[model samples]
Target: MTHLVMDVDTGIDDSLALLYLLGDSRAQLEAIVCTAGNVPARQVADNTLGWLALAGAGAIEVALGAEVPLSQPLQTTEDTHGPLGVGYAELPPHGRTISGRHAASVWSEAARSHPGEVTGLVTGPLTNLALAVQLDPELPQLLGRLVVMGGALNHPGNTRPTVEWNTAVDPDAAKIVFDRFAGLPAERRPILCPLDLTERIVMTSAHVERLAAASGCAAPERILPSDDRGRRSSADVELIRQLSDAIRFYMEFHRDMGQGFIAHMHDPFAAAVALDPGRAQYRPATLDVELAGRLTRGQIVADWPGPSGAGIWGRPPNADVAADTDPEAFFDALIERIAAVALDGPAR
Candidate 1:
């Protein structure tokens, strides 16, 4: 099994991504590191452990990392994820231990321990990654590859027309990771799931309902909503029905915002491609994150042909940029893997 070090911000989607990681049979999750994003870093750590316990995989270590981005103040979508950060999923308090070690240290230790066999699935802002590079310049040599879920290569953005939320959260940190990884030897492959393609993978009410029902098969607390308002009215059952409500609310929010009932599952695609690359349409291209542009800040500019040469960020990136995806096949694979893992229970 391939070892994976997952870094996330513990959003609702982040929770879904973790489900994929912990439940996926092919992945041997080494550790989970939390970062500040739609939630604070510490809360993200708590939320990470909470979800891990719900998945019956509380043995995995949860580490806290950067609470604030390097260049800008932290930004969160509390309206979307709830004040507690996880859409108020009503998860039970963690019985497992929370690691005191910082994200960078845990990342370094995991890399050193796993050597060139470890892959990083970064689903949050790139702050922890930048810190890791600072702690150990040798980290690049140790990682097998890094699968990042950020940037806006071909599609528009949700946060801003020119900026994706992850990169906009901390362009400097992203710049550091991209720059360092770009300089690494050919052995370290860095793959990016830009918002361009990720935005195309929509999670409809049907999908959410199916995921919630499937998750309920093995774990009652697994699919609880983040808010109480969106929960089911049935109080007779012990299962928490908040996630069902939150999905409804989120879908309504999307509809109100004119994004339709189906919003793209941004971070899950990153996790999906990380687990299976052949499932999508990938292209060999140099990617760059624009840090200087006013409106275009944090935008991902791919080295695909344009009338003006290399678009923006100028420097040639080194990675396989995701260009397209088989949406139906992608969701089907994700659902199958999730069901398989949840039914199989935790790795023995």
Candidate 2:
């Protein structure tokens, strides 16, 4: 099994990513470190605990990290994830408490404990990981893998004209992380699942229907009320209902954005790639975050080697940037996983 440490902001997509990891038999989730991104740190922590409770995986360790970005003020995407960060999905109160340790400590300790056996997946801002790197400069070399869901690269940003939400929210931390991992061996460098590739794995209403059908639950449209208090249902069915309700607002947001009622499987795709890098195609590049330009700050610039085999600053490739994904294969595996999770009753 692949030992995993996930750092998240507990947004709608983040919740889905958590479920994917928790349900996957191949993953051994070491810890979940909450950070501020799509929501404040407190809400993120609460949401993380609540979601784990809903999954019946309350035993998982959770720790709170940075309350805000390294330098910039905290800016949440409540507009995208709804006020509670999970849209309309209301989970039961978390029965478990967070770990006494902070997120940075949890990350550092986990990395040191597992050595080159832990895969770190960050679906929120880079604040927590950056601090962990600061505490342990050798963290990049110790981790088996580091998969991140941020940046836009050649694609237009979702939050800004030139910046992705996660990186833009904490460019300083992002720069630190990219620079810190730059010296690692090619095989050990971070793998970036940017918006450029994530946007390609769109989850539409049809896909939701398929998941519901495969899981033996009512279709999303047929599941009226869409809230926990709506009606009585089996535990397995309720799981699907909760997921559908959580993404309702997100789907509408995509519709309003003219994306046709489809939500990008951003964070989950990062988790999937972390679990298995062969799911997507990657290109080696030297990446740097732009931090000085008013209009360009947080933009991830890639230095692709030319015919002369020379990068912009002659910097060696430090990251494997995802360029393409087989959407059919990806969605197939994703739906299968969700269905299996639903049929299994609940997370252990």
Q: Which candidate comes out best when scored by lDDT? A: 2
lDDT of 2 by residue, 137-180 (tens): 98888898899999988889998897999998899999999999
In Å, residue 225's CA in model 1 sits off its true spot by 16
Residue-wise C-alpha lDDT for candidate 1, range 1-348, written one tens digit per residue: 778899999887787777776667678888899999978888888888877776667478888899999888899877767777665357777677778889999899999999988899999999999999999998988988889998876677878896788888988998888778876654455888887788778877567556545645433332233434455433222222434444455555566578876556777778887778766666655666788998888877667534554535564547777777788787876666565445565543
After superposing candidate 2, which stretches have Cα over 4 Å from the reference?
218-236, 345-348
Instruction: Please give the range of 10 consecutive residues that has the lowest summed lDDT in model 1.
Output: 233-242
Clashing pairs in 1: 87-226, 88-226, 224-243, 225-242, 225-243, 230-245
Residue 215, candidate 1: how far off, in angstroms?
5.1
Superposed by TM-score, candidate 2 places the C-alpha of residue 348 at a distance from the truth, in angstroms, of 5.9
